[model samples]
Each structure stands twice: as C-alpha cells, then as structure tokens.
Target chain A: MDLILTPNITDPDGFYARLIAAHDGLSDEESAALNARLILVLANQIGNAAVLEQALALAQVGK
Target chain B: MLNDRYSLAFKLYPYERSSDQDAAQPVRHPVVIVGGGPIGIATALDLGQQGIPVLVLDDHEGIGMGSRAICFAKRTLEIADRYGCGRPMVEKGVVWNLGKVFHEDRQIYDFNLLPEAGHKYPAFINLQQPYFERFMVERVRELQATGTPIEIRGKNRLDAIEVRDDHVVLDIMTPEGPYRIEADWLIGCDGASSPLRGMMGLDFEGRVFQDSFLIADIRMHNDDFPTERWFWFEPTHGAGASTLLHKQPDDVWRVDFQIGWNVDRKEEMKEENIRRRLDAFLGEGLGYDIVWSSIYTFQCRRMKRFRHGRVLFAGDSAHQVSPFGARGANSGMQDVDNLGWKLGLVLKEQAPESLMDSYDTERCFAADENILNSSRSTDFITPKSKISHTFRNAVLQLAEKHAFARPLVNSGRLSLPCVYDNGPLNGEDALPEAPARTRPGAPCPDAPLADGFVLDRLGGDFVLLTIDADAPEQLDVGGIALRRVKLSVNDDATGALAERYLGGATSAVLLIRPDQHVAARWAAFDESAVRRAVGHACGKE
Candidate 1:
C-alpha cells in the first residue's frame, strides 16, 4: 500500500529523518513499516489541520 | 550523664587505641575525606557501606548550611535507594508534576511530566539538601554504632596530600593537633573551587558566563501558583531575563532571578534590591518575607579528566553547570553512583582495579553533555550580543505559537542523560540499531513491574529480566551474578511496553547493572548468548 504521511509543523523533516535514520540499517520492507508506524504516532500527537498542512509541505520538500 | 548516654548508645567502644599507635603516636585511618559536604559524606558512605574504613575530616562541626541541590532527578533517587537512603528522601521530598512558563501575564507554555507508566518515582523531586546530608550522616553514625567504624573528625582540615604508588598520604590539621592518614584511594568532592583539583594541576576548561543570578528563599502567599514550577520570561527588570519560582517544604518558596551583567554585583545583591525583585514578579502587596538570599555566577566548566592516577574527582569538583535545569548536583550524585559499585568490586577483589578507568570515561561523557546543554540554556537566557538575543527570542516566539516548536524548544536537552557508548565496559554490540533503552551505556528507563514496583526498584544492583513467556533460560556469567525475574508477556502493561520499546516484537532479555545502565541484552532468549554478553561486559572470561 502506497501511504502518504504528513509531518509535524515545527520540524516535520526532523522526525521523518530520525525515523529513516533509525531504520537505516534495516531492510527496505522493515524501514517502510517502521516509517508507517512513526507516521501514525506523529499524526496522533499533532492533530491540527494547520500543522498537518505544514507537515505535508515539509514532506513534499523532502521528496 | 553524657558518658552514660554515649555508653548506652554504643554496642562497643568507638575510640579504641590501636597497638600500632601508643602514647608516642595516634592511630590514622586508611582513607580521610577532606570535606564533610554531601559529596564527601556520600563518598565515605559508599566506601563504608562496602566494609572499607574511612575517616571524614571536616572543618565544620555539623553538616554544611544552605539548601543547595534542592532538586533530585529519578536517576539520583535510584542511587540513594541503593545506599539505603532513598526511602527517607522520597518521604521528605516534594514531587512536582507540572511546570509553567509565562511572558508578562500570558502563559507561554505549560508542560506536564506525567509519571512514565512503568517508573516507580516521578521525573523530579525538590528536597532540602541539608536534610538529605543529615540523613546520610545519621546513616553513617548508625553504621558506626554497629561496629562498622566510619569515623568523622569534625573541625579537622586538610593541610597537604602526597600520592604514592601504594597509597595517598594526607597531612591533616585538627583542633587538638596535626595528624597523618594514608588511603588506598583519595576522592575530591569539594565544590567547584576544589583545592584538590587545583593541587593536582588539572585545568577546568569552559566559558564562564558574565551574567550573575540571585537565589532567594522566601515565604510568600501566592494562591494562584499551584504546586508546580513557574518561570516568568523576559521580565521588565534587569535585562529581559527569566525568573524561577519553586515550592519548597513548610510553606517556603525558592525563587531565582536571572539578573543581567549590566547591574553591578554589589548593588544587585543588596537586601532592598532582592525584596523589590520579589515583589515585582510575585505581584504588589503580597505579604512575603525573605528568609535568606545569595548571589552566584553561573559557569559551565569540567576538568580535562576526572581521574589522575589514584585520585578521582566527583561532583562539582569534576564538573560545573549553571542551575538552569538542576543538572549540577544530580549529575554529581550520579557520578558517585557510577564509581561506588565499581570501587566496591575492585576492593572486594571481584574485579581488577583497571575497572576504575570506566568511572572517568562514563562520568566525563555525562559532564560533557551537561556542559553542552547548560551552555545552550545559559546562552538562551543571557544572549552575548544583540544578534544572539534576537535569534533566541525569535525561536522562542516561534515555539510559543507552533506545536512542533514547543517540543523542539522543550526537548529538555539539559535533563536527558547521556550514555557512554564508547566506554571500556561498552562492547561492540553496544551500538544497537534500535533506539535508546535501559542498557549498559544508557541510563535505564523507568519501567513498571507487575507487582506495582517500578523498574527503578531493581536498580540498586545487577538485575536480569526475562521477557520470554515460556521456559525462561538461566545461565551464569563468570564473575557477574544475575538475578533472574520473569516478565509476564501476557500482562497488558508488558504488551504496551513491548510495543513502545521493542517495536511490537518479543523474546528479548535485558540485564541491567546497579547504576541503571543496560549491561547486556539478547534479541532471543538464548542462555549461552546472554551469559557470554554479560561475561564480556563484566571483564570475566
């Protein structure tokens, strides 16, 4: 499943980068799974639409 | 009457004359601690607890004055518990749950340190340091009464120390006369202006911030302020800085003001000026009376090395940081915790003296990180220049309005404990792919056990926890003993912890040492593998 995740408002890339970095030694499937789990946790923490928009913008920039 | 009380209080005579010293000479203890402060008393307590004889020589007749180090972190409480002192400490201390930051009259940020679900103690407790020291001294006396023979030569001063290959000899000056003492190890726990550190010719290198702070213990009636830490940011007073208000025991409040460098030190500390600042921040016409006040300069400095041959340094003698996040004394007590068990092992012949090198390595790492964070906070509070001030204020402003910025700003970088990843005891597997855990190099996270006791309950010594539900494997390492306990994976709390820490995976076993560092861990419940990992870390074949 292709999943699109948004970041938190302050440093969306920072958390995403940390998640990716923690899983850097894992297999491609493992990294993707971990990233998906982190996205859910971050989404639960920053539940605001404005923050979600900024996070989405940050993710796009990283891409 | 006094002699009758003294005789009744003791099981045996304390001051027995040794044959080695007759009328010609007096008996000298093996180790003589120079200062009677918390650090000195703690060192003596640790050594005495291990059956080693020590005489603490203090210039004061009683425990030192002042309520210094009123804040104790969870990690420190773990250490105190190991020394059989944590119960009283917890009973007397005031645990804080929330902290608020205000700018002018508006609430800028409010953070809650919700007790971690599995941890026994809260994040921090505020207690008077003098009471804590007295408790330690009384514990020492109790040990002495039981023939443990921990001596404290009050009104005694250290004149000189000469280090030899075998022992460190101390020349002490007492009220009666001069004496000499020889010790296997000499520890300097004296404050930042440590004479021992200076005598050893070691350099304490770091930036000394020009800003000075005023700490006042006062009695005030503020019903609005809950039993939480309140920080007033950018006050109109001397250079837009911060003010701290912390609740103490017995209706007393400890307040700290970050007075800028512009104010003269002499004029800033005047009683009238201090009262004025207290009134301004606490609101007008609040019936408040000042108890005691003092001015101090904040400096972030650490010795180039913690150990120089036989002499070791702990507490403020080893490192100094600004009192922004209460890292200074907490980290020093942690230094004692790290060194105590290792020194005990060496003295007991369980481990070689070479193990002492890890104390320097581990504590230096902690000190370095503390200096970095405290320096950052110091810079944040007292910006060196206009550009720096503008930048800091801009970041804080951004943090105020943005949720993302809030966590980033309050990363609480100062409070985070740094593990020794590259220390002697930390092996090749120390560099784990997973995030941090309660491991050898890292401080143990507070975990709640099924019995209602927290993970910190197991911290006084080495603990072996089995996460596997079936057929828990048990194997012994060479010299390091392991106490095995079954962690029921079926419990709801265990399931949550497995999800949070192990990424929803199981079958891992963890071994933690008394200092709350993860000594070893096995991905799968393999007895032989766990034994080998423990053996390697403990320097046993």
Candidate 2:
C-alpha cells in the first residue's frame, strides 16, 4: 500500500472552517467519540492497516 | 402538613385492578403486552396509534423510580419522536455530544458525534429512564383522550401462559385474584428476569461480567460539573476499575463507581459506604444528599430467537447488554421500531405473517452487535487477565500523548443505530456508484428536506421516495395491502436531499419500508420493479 504524501488541501481556510464547524456545540466526550469515528472511517478508506499504522506513528511524532 | 388530605409533591401510583376475575367469560384481545415498562408501553402506544387494540399487563403501576438508563441516543429520541414522545425528552434531557476521557486525571481525547449535520435531534442526551417512561405514559394517556385507548392493566401479573397453535392463553394473577385471557399475539417486554420466557423454557445466552458497579444519584444545592460524559480509568478517586459521571434532569448527578465482585452487596450499599465512595468520586467536604443508590452487575445475554410461534419478545426479554453503552432501552426502542409496524400490518392482514420473521432475523442480528460491543467495553474496563490489564494501562498511557491510541481506549462504544446491511428483507441495488449510506438495506439517513427531515416523511407506510424525478400515478404492489406513500422530491428547494439520496445521478427512487429501512432502490421509476421489491419486502414473494 502506498501512502499519499502529496499536498492535498485545495482550500485550506475552507477545510479549517469545516473542521471547526464539526466541533461546534459538541462537548469534550462527544468530540473524543467523533475523533474516534473519524479515525476509523479514514482508516477504512485508507484500506491498508500497515500504512495506517505508519501514518499514525508519523503523526504522533513529537506530540 | 402530612395529613391524608395534603397533596404530596409526588406519589407512587396505587396499583388498580382493571379486570374482574369473577367474570364468567374470558376476555379476548388482538394483542397482549406483558410488562408495562418503557418498551411495552412504547410498543402498545405505537400499535394503538395504528388503531390496534392492545392490553398492557404489568405488576407495577407507575413509572420506574431511578435515574436508570441515562444516555438516550439520537436514534432512540428519533423513534420516540416518531411515536409521539421525542420532543419532550430533547426539551428536558441534557443534549450533549462531547466527552472527555481521563486516565488517572490526565485528559486523553475528545469527540463530536454528529459532525456532518442535517439531523434534528442531537447525537445523545442524558435523560433518565423514569422521565422517558413518564413521557411515554403521557403520550398514551393523551392518545386515550382522543378515543384510541390502549388498556394498561396495572398490578396484573402474568402467572402462566398456555401457548396454543392459533393464539396464546394467559393466566394472569391480579390484585383481585386470577383471570384467564386470550390473545392472538403476546408480546413479552417483561425485562431481564422475564417470567414469560421462563414459562416457555427459553434461555438467554452470553457473557456476564464479574464486576458490580454502584450507581449513586446525588442531589446538591450547588455542584458544577460539565454536561459531557466524564469517564475515569484508575483515577485519583475511588478503588481502581472505571468511574463515570453523567448529569440527569433535576439536581441529580449520577456517579457510577466500579466495586469488585467479591464484596458484600448489602455492606457496599450501606449509607456510610456510599458516602465514603461519593467522597472519593466528588471531593470530600461537598454538601450533597443521596437521592438513590443501587449496586448492579451488567451481563450481555440474549435469547436465540425473539419470535416464537404466536408469541414475540421485545426489549430486555429478548436481549440485554451491559449498561455502559446505554444499549438496553435504546435497543429495545429499536426492537419496537422494527417490530411494531410489521406486527400492525400482519394483524391488519396487509402483510403476510411471514413478514414478522424479518423482525427476528434483523433484531437478533442487532442484539448480537450490541452485545459484542458492550462485552468488549466490559473487558477493557475490567480487564480479567494480567496481560490484558498491562495492555489496557499501556493504551491509557499512550492515549494521553497520541491521536491514534485515543480511539483504542474504550470507556464505552456508545449506542449508534444498527445498519441492517445483510438482512434477508433488503433487496440488491443495481447502481454500484449510489450512496451506500442510504443503500437498499441501510436505515434511511436523515437528510434535510423542505418541510422536515427525510425520515419524518416515512415510518407509517411503504414510501416510494423519488429524488429529481416523478413517481408513477400508482403501483399495483401485488397481493400485499400496504399503504404506499409517494414522496415527490424537488431538489431546487432542498439542497442536501439530492446529494445524499441520489449521489451524482439525476434521478432515483428508493423503496423505504414502514420501519424506515430502505427495502430497495431504482435508477428510474419502473412499476414492475417497485411492485417486485414491495412484494419481496412484505414476504409475499
């Protein structure tokens, strides 16, 4: 499986706005649940679990 | 002030005898609902709304007394709303979508449930079971005032049921004595310790957790806590395991503290023990009064089949899951949603009796899904093996620092509506590129419409929803007598409906069943295709 490392944002501001809009009126617990679901859906679309693990490891660097 | 004439602020309803046992003849009814809990009453009200006469039998007269089953999911509220009791719960219940996970006071991750919008109800609400039951009773009484009265015979315990080939004969023990009643169909919503199931020798099979948790409902003058569900794993307060905080209506805050299985039940439930635990959960020196506290052990078990000849089971009688995910009442409501319309149609001879089997195949599948999730949560929370505990601790530690590990930490999976993808009732869709979210088997996703949401237009009958096209004048939908609803969609008025239902296509028609599950779909309007799908859905094929 190949990971898409290209610059993917068409409208960064719009994407940022949509991301913020998703969190609107949601509490901390609900936000956590939403994040979990997001990770899962994105993982399924990504298809390859090995690539997902690598991407997750990369994203978690220096956190 | 405590005189007999004085009006009490609230009182437990006195059980009244609805049947005179001395009467010579046996009373006959179309439907007999055992146990008048939320599930039974909801089913009764739903059936009654469709002009079906139902008799509800229960040992208790009033609503449940605790702040039990606190988290009502969006799907449940939607079903309640459709059945005439949803808005009140949303109005009064604490509607929240955020949650914070703390592994020993360190914040891990947060989530938003309904991120992409278009739903009328929130993702979840913290409404107690009592309020839900009261709201259902109110709806039943309100319907009764308008002449469609569902007879609820309180204090009438179903002593024994003699199952017949055609119908069921129930020997009910009332406060006045015993009486025999006959029913064309008997629905057991009698809950976890269902005597009806016991009488029929049906056994519930699944996992039972070895841990018992103490739920304390506390009332205080001033207690400030966040509305979101706050879950703690090995926190500074309380003894190990997991703890949860949820605020119900009124000044009551429900705190669940996991107590190990070996402890004495009575000793643990003592006021001093409860107070000590509360001190650990909330800080010491807090001014609060204990409203109610109960110790309960959760088990995820279910019957092999919900349907038995002329007798059907709904709610806890059919399936029970650990209370962590709020799956019990929510799933029961889904059972009501899945079964009510089919049962009503079958009683009316609109659909074949075999249509009822779909209820078993569909809901039992849902029950298994719920049980599996709840069991996983239980194992995570109270790890049995040494390696399991180490792994849980490691996950908790890593979750605080990483985004990926955050999803692995299971406080509770939380209840979501089940998608019946592989059920026998669904038809094969021809269009592969169509939106799978609203596919043939999936529960119809709530899309924004001009008048109301898409699901609001469904529920009562077989609806043919056409997007960016026109439905034919009429469909000769075979021998089945289902009321066909034609919803003509104009995309210029509503933006999301076309994108959500039709995908990129210009036109499509979806055959939505009475329970709001999509039975079939078509790229274009064809009468023969629609009729075949409808026939298949109603078990007429």
Candidate number with greatest lDDT: 2
lDDT of 1 by residue, B1-541 (tens): 0121111111221233223222355344555566677778787777788788877766556654456678888777766766668778888888888888666456777878776665566667888787777777777878788877577765565677888875787766654556666777777887888877777678998888997778888876654557988777686643237788888776678888888666787887788888788878776788777766777887889998887777888999889998877788788888887887787777677777777788988899889888766766665566565444544455456555555445534323336566877666763343243345644577766555566553544645566665653324444455556666666555435555564334444555566666667776656555666666665555554
What is the iRMSD in Å for candidate 1? 11.1
Native-vs-model 2 lDDT?
A: 0.79
Report, to 2 decimal places, the DockQ of model 2.
0.04
How much is the lDDT of residue B59 in candidate 2? Answer: 70
Each model's TM-score? 0.81, 0.86
| Best TM-score among the predictions, by candidate number | 2
Please tell me which predicted candidate would have the highest DockQ against the true structure: 1
TM-score of chain B in each prediction: 0.88, 0.94
What residue runs in model 1 are displaced by over 4 Å at the alpha carbon?
A1-63, B1-31, B147-149, B221-224, B237-240, B408-414, B428-435, B452-459, B469-480, B490-503, B524-532, B539-541
True contacts kept of each: 0.04, 0.00
lDDT of 2 at B494: 55
Two-chain DockQ for each candidate model: 0.05, 0.04
Clashing pairs in 1: B118-B447, B118-B448, B439-B517, B439-B518, B440-B518
Model 2, span B307-394: residue lDDT tens: 9999999999999999868899999999999999889889988788998899999999999989877876777788765445655786
Q: Candidate 1, residue A37: CA error in Å?
A: 35
Runs in model 2 lying further than 4 Å from the true structure:
A1-63, B1-22, B473-494
Residue by residue across A1-63, what tens digits does model 1's lDDT show?
Answer: 212232245553244234334654566577567658978997887787777776676555533
Error of 2 at B56 (Å): 0.2
